[model samples]
Target: QVCPGVTPPTGAVKVTPGHSPQDLALARAHGLPLLSVIADDGTLRPPGGGWLQ
Candidate 1:
């Protein structure tokens, strides 16, 4: 993330929900690049690099 933008690529560690910003603010901050998807069961699925096959 912050590393790749400036230096060599690095792995990202998943942070806990308590550490993450609320869905709305996160979406607004990242805009189109980052998205939030909610499931019918109230599950949150962050954007994935998926396409129709």
Candidate 2:
């Protein structure tokens, strides 16, 4: 379910636990994987284990 005050533009949400605190909470609550795709420098990091390949 979406967060209480959040309204997704597409009427759907993409969980990004590594980048968003709200998403992290949602991911943890749903036992979803936490993946990091961007580095601290704001660049796309190499895909790990073919996660985004």
lDDT of 1 at 51: 40
Candidate 1 local lDDT, 1-53, one digit each (tens): 36546455456444333345775455556562443455566665544323411
lDDT score, candidate 1, position 43: 62
List candidate 1 stretches off by more than 4 Å.
1-21, 33-53
CA-only RMSD, every prediction: 7.2, 6.6
CA lDDT, every model vs. true structure: 0.48, 0.73
Clashes of each: 0, 0
- Alpha-carbon shift of residue 52 in model 2 (angstroms): 7.1
Where is model 2 more than 4 Å wrong at Cα?
Answer: 1-12, 38-53
User: Which lDDT tens digits does candidate 2 get at residues 18-44?
Assistant: 778998899999998776767787666
